[model samples]
Target: MGSKQSKDKRTKEQKQLTPEAVQVTHSNQGPRTRSRHLSLVLLGVVEVPPHVWELLELQRLNLSQNCLSTLPPALGQLEHIVVLNLSGNRLTCLPKEIGRLRNLKILFANMNALTAVPEELSLCGKLEVLSLSHNLLEELPVSLNDLAFLRKLNLGSNRIAHIPLCVFSMKCLDFLHVGSNRLENIAETIQYLQNLQILIVEYNNIHALPKTLCSVTALELLNVDHNCIQALPDDLYKLSRLRKIAMHPMDTGLHIIHNPLARPLPQMLDAGLDALFRYLKDKDGNIY
Candidate 1:
């Protein structure tokens, strides 16, 4: 009985930690100036004041762990905002006006109730990182392909079944995380991600990998764990840049154990990564 009381008390404390408050910081005791770099942190804030938009100089805004069901459209008034974090919020949708933040570089809207993202978000041509993980998103807005400078994109734990072809068009993308989704197939077009360093597509229904995937010679980390993949392309060993493959305890690491791959792969994995790669490198051997 005492343990149950303790658990309840902890829950209450956790609830109290996210107070419905909005705090903004700026330079001085005088009128707001555009030269100041303002930051606002609105934790558990259920509503925002309209006057908050008057701070045109706001550069960073953190509204994480909030109870906000919606945001005031006036949020777009902060044209100079560079980083906007709206994680751990109750937001089901974001205002289209969000596209007005042209100078925005990083946007984090993960862990929300978002069902769809505004297509206008692609208008932020300068965006570098966009994370929309842990949402109800089934597909992405195609306009996002226009983000030429985008480097990192995290859409893990969503309902995405197919990787958008537009995603392969981003030449500068370095990190792509699409884990824990419903993906069935990855296109050979993935080779277009010439600059890709890390690719995570774990916990999915993928049954096969394209030989073109091995063509992404720049890949440093490739994680295709927890999928239904029956075989890996033999040329995969040609990627000398690869440093880790399925390396994690949760994933059971470099040994492709939880798969139905042909014989030598399972046997080679039992011997170690060196043996596995060597098996792929052999020209005259058959694993079947």
Candidate 2:
């Protein structure tokens, strides 16, 4: 009888969970080995079963692509969870209980109906990646500054009118995506993200790129298509690592302001960043 219980425990620990399939311990049964990972995606999972909270040993949980409108507050009970994926759901707000996942490192709630994020989320001090793209968020709480390790932030396709001041403090940030929003300008404070590599602000109403933006020499990819940018900063060529620049294909009216008048943005983009850099280099106030 004890051998049979051991076999059942191994089976429960090794088997991949289906949407409706999970091994739960009965009240009459002794303790069972807790599962470390579970994925229950693409189902009408409006409510999570109470037994889920019993898995205190769970390290990763994938509840993506479900019809869940409400996340159970009991989620906080899974203190060992390091990755929580609630993407493609209908959740309008994350429960404050989420703060209990002190071990969490990655949180993805993209493609949701989230209008506001709970300040309690700031308690996840170890979070390195936070993706909340394709939501209705209009503003972010300044408390998020506590996530000192955050490396990537995806808030694209939201209704936010401006970049929050707290975002400028994320010193380790590598990628920032705020595309298809209502931003009018990027703060000069962006220069603080010295580790930044990619900056995407496409399809916004921005009229100009800040001259200070040229300080991010680590920038590799810059997308600003469909904005009203009429010129490039004279020092934009300082981003020596820039390999690609995405802009409105028809933005031929844009020009660079420097000695002897630099090339038009569209003309240089067509010529490639390499060619653009060469032009800027050769014309460094030495040539007419």
Candidate 3:
């Protein structure tokens, strides 16, 4: 009788070891190893296993280019997740519980159908790189200004009409791309980005360049093609670090081809940035 009881106990233990449960506890090992990284990129997965949230030690999660339209709120339980890539999905919104990931640093949600982002995302104080390009976002949450460490922000190919002034509060911003939008004017507050390196605002409705834009001394590359800009700010010559100017296909090297730039300025553009600056500073001031 005692021997039979021992056999029954072993059978019960084996029955509890189902495949789904094993996937969570043992990870890839026979029934006890744990996965450190979970990547499901381009698998056409429509849904994630509910037990996946149990992976508290998971550091990176890649679910890009999938068919997932929604995320399980349990995703917030991953306390150690540092990078989360959800790009190229059909998701329309993000769960507010995502704010629970205090350790998250890099988040890529580009190429999705997302219409809104949770304001709670600002809680991830450690986030540095965020890409929301090619989405349907028209406006960003006010709380986004709290991400002081954000370095790269790409909002290109969206329907954003105007950039919030709060975005300039990010002191560490190095690159900013807001091209292909409905922006009619750039705010004067743009000069607040002291560390800015590259600024691309091509294909917008802007009719003129702001004088303050030239104050960003660290700027290296500027692309303002396909806009209604009729004149170039003379103060722009003071930006010593300015390197490239892209206005139109024919206007490759500091040349103004398409825009209705007035007088000798268009002629000076043919002579280059040095010649343009000389003409602007000349006492003659003969602009026609």
Candidate 4:
């Protein structure tokens, strides 16, 4: 009886931690900015209530963790919005009027049913962070590159087979995550994004990384875990800023454990970083 009770209690606790377990209403949803920042999260809202659009002063709107299947075109009325969170919903597409919010700087629409994003979204030129992970998107519109100021983009857990061509043109991008997709190889044009700091393309069909990847001198983290990679560039040391691979804050690092590595990489084992530094000196005729 005691063991059964404990198991039941643990299951109940786990359910409570998920977003769907908590029910809320628009008025009770807490907001850091009161009327200016309204968070209707975890609400069973099927549609934006007509009253929400009236809050024209809203600057940060969070409608995440809801049951919304479609957005009313009225979403464009909130021109003052700077941050918008629409994750954990059933949305198939966003209203084209989203472009009217020229001041928007951040948008999160992950864990949705979205098949595509409206091209007008590119009009939000000030956008700095955009996350659309776990969607059904196979490719993004070329207009995506118009967000010149975008610094972080997360497209993980999607069906993308190729890194969008627009991505290489984003000169200011610092963090790019395209893991858990169908990518068989990365484009050599990846070197064009000189400002890229993080490149994660794990759980794909990549056979070998391009030597030009070594030209990404600013990369600080490269995660190619669970891929078919057999060898890395002999000049990998050129990535002077690389600090770790698959080094997550939540767990101890798990780098290339599934890759059938070649030569020195396999021997590095317990001393991957140290071996990397030593290999650099041996090739460049300078000891580090």
lDDT of 3 by residue, 1-288 (tens): 999998997676444332233323344456344445677666676887666678788778887998999998898999888889999999999999999999999999999998888999999889999999899989889898999999988888889899866588888998888988888889888989989887778878888888898788787777776788877776777677754444554333332345667676678877677777667656235444
| TM of each candidate vs. truth | 0.82, 0.81, 0.81, 0.83
- Which prediction has more favorable TM-score, 2 or 4? 4
- Please give the lDDT score at residue 126 for candidate 1: 93
lDDT of 1 by residue, 1-288 (tens): 999998997676445333222334545754553333433344446775555577676777776776778987898899988888888888899999999999999999999889999888988999999999999889888888898999999999998999866688788999899988999989889999999888888789989889898888887777777888888888777677664345563442242436677766777766666666777878426443
Which ten-residue region of model 1 has the weakest summed lDDT?
A: 15-24
Which digits, one per residue and each the tens of the lDDT, describe model 4 over residues 74-124?
A: 999999889999999999999999999998999999999899999999999
What C-alpha lDDT values do all the predictions have?
Answer: 0.78, 0.79, 0.78, 0.82
- Model 2, 80-194: lDDT tens digits are 8898999999999999999999999999999999999999999999999999999999999999988899999999999989998778888999989998899999989989989
lDDT of 4 at 180: 95
Off by over 4 Å in 1: 1-42, 244-246, 249-257, 284-288
Distance from true position, residue 222, model 4, in Å?
1.0
Question: What is candidate 3's TM-score against the reference?
Answer: 0.81
Top lDDT model: 4
